[model samples]
Target chain A: MKTLRLLYMAEVKLSVREMSSVIFGILLPVGLMGLMGMFADTQLELIRAFAAIATIGLVSTGIMSLPLSLSSYREKKVLKRYKVTPISPTHLLAAHVLHCFSLSTLSMVLVFLVAWLGFGLEIVGSLWLFLGGYVFVMIAIHSIGMLVASVSPREKTTGAISSALFFPMFLLSGATIPLTILPEFMQTLAQIFPLTHGITILTDIATINEFNTVSFLILFVLTGICLMISVKTFKWE
Target chain B: MGEVIRVSGLTKRFGQKIAVQDLHLSVRAGSIFGLLGSNGAGKSTTIDCMLGTERADAGEIRILGTDPRANRRSLFQHVGVQFQESAFQSGLKVREICEITHSLYENPIDWQKTVAEFELSDKLKTTISDLSGGERQKLCILLAMMGRPKVIFLDELTTGLDPVARRDIWQTLLRLKQTGVTLFLTSHYMDEVEKLCDEILVIKGGKELIRGTAADVVHRTDSENMDEAFVKLVEEGIR
Candidate 1:
């Protein structure tokens, strides 16, 4: 327990010091939401933009930042070094997950604050439902990130694979460009991505006082599968 | 003195290649033991197996009277290891790394004292990415010693240090020895082994080629120095 706490504190410090994590995880989403607020002419547009900004935090941290850090740790043999200590590899991995989750939560809170203060946007849904969906989305996305980190042989390869996954998910998941604007085939294809379900769940809860039960179930199932595979395949070296 | 490390018939294989084959060795308490081998000679593989970081195909290892694999938590509480290519997180400061490592053991040395002893006080706030090679090696030593371990493994301990820094590290090791800590070290520098090791084991092709006191091995091989004895033993196939 003490070791975990120490590791968590160290991880938090390291995560905060990383400039790219700060830029992508916090700055990009909050900046996008602030920009959207200035141009959104309708309450619905503002709400959708706010919801999409929230998913941007999730996807950016989950797909881009989290895997990159884990793979870098592997590449540098940081994980291997820890294996010789009394601290278990599981503790190190849990610390990183908790650190990234906390960063994601902070980013979402900033997006909410900026949208509510600057754009006069309000969530019309059950706040409890929104929070619940948000947690599930984070779990699903982070699990996918862990899976990617575990399978990639090196940090550079993880970066390449994560970027390949990130851009398409960012564009077609109704985060940047709405699903209504996307071609029919693209919209259908987006359904295969966890990010699409995450954004849809958040937007539904924030706008309609409810969320899609199917998306919630799908995301929960995906989280379980990804977490299992990642744990099974994880290598300290 | 009780044996701190005991290994018998240790074997490890990677797919088709044997990494360590039928290896056996022992180290008495409070002694300095040197392990030497050429590249790919299973020095690291043996260390990995002994440290419980990798599984052995067949062997029994009793480290401090406990199987490292079965009792890792207890084993690690008393053992410290410095790997040849280990690294801390690049963004962590020297002090932050010290603090985190300090928390891992039940009884750790004072972090400030360790930093001072290692001449790392100046690098306390420096991130790992900004550290010089010798500074990084010093940090590794500081971390390994922080646990106040009963047995410490140092792999390529002075690989990147200058002569002054290497001498300082040698003095530190000698001090640790005076405190009754068992040292298991590997180095390419034969003089380091001659100066520090009470027992020396030279391996080639995953098998022991020579084992004795450094001077005894030199005398047995009829060589003038450890380096010459090492080459003669390897060339003569462990006679």
Candidate 2:
């Protein structure tokens, strides 16, 4: 427990020092939310905007930052350095997950506060259910990110692969443009992405109090599969 | 002296190329052992196999009477390694690296003393990437010694240091050798091998060209010194 705590603190401190967390995870999402909420002439538009904007942190951290950081460590041989110690690779992996998850939460909070205080945004459903849904979304997406890191043939290739998947999801998963505003065929195409279902879950729970069991189950099963593969095949160097 | 490490009939191949083939060696306890080889001669691969970071295609290895691949957690507490190319996080401070390494061990020495005695106290707050090459090398050494292991594996231990720093490290290593700690190192510097290694093994093309004391190798090659002996072997062709 103590070792985990120390590793966690070190991971957090290093991430903060890099300034990528504040820039992409926090500032970019918060800035985007502020801009999108401004043109909300009606409550329905405002709700759709928040629904889309809430996931920026999860997508950015899970698909972009997390995999890249792990790949960088491998490229630099930091993971190799850690392998000789008594500290298990499991410890290093767990600390990374916890650190990225917490950063995602902080990013979500800042975005939420902007919606609530600056624009009087309100969540109509149970906050507990919303929280559970939010956590599930994080785990599912983070699992996919970890799986990419595990399966990538080379350290430098992780960036290309992850960025290719990230931008389309970023723009269409409802952040830059709400999924509802798009035409029917594009929304159907967007359904292929994991982020779309995550947005669907958050939107359903926040606005309509509907659980969207299909989307929830998709994310749950995905989290299980990705986590299993990641654990079985992850490499240190 | 009891043998601390043993490798026999070890072979490793990368696709069509055999990196190491049918190699064998043993390091007795409390002696400074050196592995000297040219580039691409599979020195790193052999070390990796011995450390269990890389699997060997054939043969057996035992460190302290246990297989490293199957029993890392229990065995690594008594082992430390300084990799030739491994690095620390660039954003991390020296103290944080020390703290994390100290936490990883089941029984760690007082790292504070290690830092002060090595003259690294003033660099505690400095970022790892900001340290000079020699300073970084010193930091790597400090981290390797944190666990007070029975045996240490050092790859290119003094690749980037001045004369004074290199001699200081040599003195330090010799003192540690007196305290019953086994040292295993790979180096390109013949002078370092002649001055420090109690037993030396020189290899070419991943096969043992010669193994004995520096004096024995000099006598066998009919050379005047360790440098001439090594060059003579290289000129004679390993194949």
Candidate 3:
């Protein structure tokens, strides 16, 4: 427990010093939420916008910041340094995950406050179920990020792959532009992405007071596959 | 002195390539042991296998009397390793790097004092990626020493060091040995092995070519010097 705490403190320091997670993961989503609040019409529209924009934090931190850090560690041989230490490298990995998770949670809280205060959003739902779904969706998205980091052989490749995944997911997965704005074919194409299902479930649960089982099943299976492949192929050095 | 590290019949293969094969060695307490081999001669591989960086397909390795692979985390508390091509996260400052390493061990040396002793006080605030090669090497050495370990493994201990820095490190290593710390090192410099190592093992193609004192190896190879003996043995696996 002490080692884990030390690792977490070190991770927070190093991560904050870099500021990528803060800027992209936390601040970016908050900024985007403010922009979306300017156009929010009815209470339900404002409430649904919160669901879509909240997942931006997940994509930025999990898919972008998380893998980028791990890949850089591999690229710079930092992971090799941790491998020889008395603490298992997995402990360090947990620290990274925890750091990103905290940032994502913070982003969500800030976004909720902004939507409620700035836009007079009315969220009619089981808050507990919404919280549970939000946590699960965060885990699912992070697993995909871990998968990207695991499979990419180089830091450069990880960046390219992560960016390739990031822009489309952020744009089409309802994190930025609403999926309702897209044409029918584009929405169907967006449905192929795991993150799209995550955002859809969060939106449905928050605004309509219900879960989307099909989207839930899609994210669950995708999360399982991602976690399995990530575990099997993850490289330390 | 007791044997501090023991490797017997150790073999490791990466796909079809035999990286290390049936290699065996032992290092005594309070002594420096060197593993010498040409590039791709499996010297690093042997060190990696022993340090639990890579697992062996066959045989046994006991560092401080426990198998490294099965008990890496616990063993690492009593052991320190300096790799030839590894470094800390580039964004981390030297002081932060030291703190993280210091926190990993059950008991660590006073890293601040050691950093000052190693002439790294000025570099503490510098990000690791900005450090010069020699400075980075010193920081690595400082980190390895943080555990106050019983056995320290150094892979290519003086590869990039200048002549004066190399000699200074050799002296520091000798000083560490005097404190009853066992040293297991790998190097290509014959003079370094001759000067510092009590026992030297030379390997090629993942197999042991020779193991003895520098003079003994020269005598066995019918050569005038350790350098010549190394060349001859590489041409012929053993005398």
Candidate 4:
């Protein structure tokens, strides 16, 4: 327990030192929501924009920062160094997960606060459901990032692969453009992305006071599958 | 003194290439044991297998009378390893690295003493990326010794250091030896081996070519020094 706490503290320090992750994972989402407040004339539009910004924060950390950090650790032989110590690889990985989760929570809080103050956006649905959906979305996206990190053979390739998946998801998964604005074929294709379901559930609960059981189940199943694959395929070096 | 490390018939292969084959070794407590090999001679593979980082194809390894594979946690608690390619995160400060490593052991050495001995007291707040190659090597050595392990593995311990820094490390190592810590060292510097090792094993193509005290091997090969003896042993084959 003491070792885990020390590892966690180290991980948190490292995460804060990574300026790029801080900018993309926290600042950008809050800034985007603040900008959206100017153009959003209705409560529905304001809620959708805030939800999309939250999704952006999740993706930035989950799909971009998490995999990049894990792969870089492997490339640098940090994991290899830990293998010789009393601390197991599982402990190191757990520290990383806890660090990323904390970052996600901070990002979420910042985005929510900015949206509330700047645009007067309020959650009309059950707060418990909204919070539950947010947690599930974060886990599902981070699990996918873990899967990518585990399968990538090199740090350089991990970046290329993560960006390849991230850019498309960012552009089409209702985070940047609403599903109504996308072409019918694109909207249908977006359904395959976990982020699409995440944004849908979030916006539904926040704006319309509706809960979509199907989307929630889809997010849960995706999280489970990705988590299993990542654990089974993880490589220390 | 009891044997701190014992290996027998250790074999490891990477696909079609056999890295180490039918290897056997033993290191008595409180001794500096040197392992010499050409590039790709399986020195690293053997160390990796003994450290439980790699599984051997066939062999038995006992470190302090414990199987490294079956009792890895307990084995690691008493063993420190410095790898040739090991690295810390660039963003971490030297002090932060020391503190984190200090927390991993049951009874760690004083971090301040380690820093002063390694000459890293001035660089405590410096990030890893800002440290020189010699400083990084020193930091690695310091971290390995922080646990105060009974047996320590040093791979290429002085690869990128100046003569003065190398001498300092050698002095520190000798001090550790005086404290009854067993040293398992691998180095390309023949002079370093000749000066410090009580027993030396020279290997080629994953097999032992010769093993003895440094002076004994030199006399047996009819050479004046370790470099000459090593070349002759490799060229003329071990007699």
DockQ of each: 0.76, 0.73, 0.63, 0.76
Question: Candidate 2 — which pairs collide?
Answer: none
lDDT of 2 by residue, B140-219 (tens): 87788888899999999888778887888888888878989999999888888999999988888888898999988889
Give fnat for candidate 3: 0.75
TM-score of 4: 0.97
Residue B59 shift from truth in candidate 2, angstroms:
2.2
**Model 2 bad stretches (over 4 Å):** none
**TM-score, structure 3 vs. true:** 0.94
Better of 2 and 3 by DockQ: 2
- Candidates' RMSD to native: 1.5, 1.9, 2.1, 1.5
TM-score of chain A of each: 0.93, 0.94, 0.96, 0.93
lDDT (tens digit, per residue) of candidate 2 on A1-237: 877898889888988898876688889989888987798887667766777677788887899777887888777877877777787666777887899899888888888888888898888878888888889898899999999888886767998988888989988777778877899999999998899999899888888988999998888888899989988988888
> What do the candidate models score in CA lDDT, each in turn?
0.87, 0.85, 0.87, 0.87
Place model 2 in a CAPRI quality band. Answer: medium
lDDT tens digits, residue span B1-239, model 1:
99999999999999999989999999999999999988788999999999988999998999999998898887788999999875777788888888889999898998898788778889889987788777787788778988889999999989877888788788888998999999999998888999999998999989888899999999998889998888887777644
Task: Assess candidate 4 and give its lDDT.
Answer: 0.87
Structural similarity to truth (TM-score) of each candidate: 0.96, 0.95, 0.94, 0.97
TM-score evaluated only on chain B, model 3 = 0.95
**Candidates by lDDT, descending order:** 1, 4, 3, 2
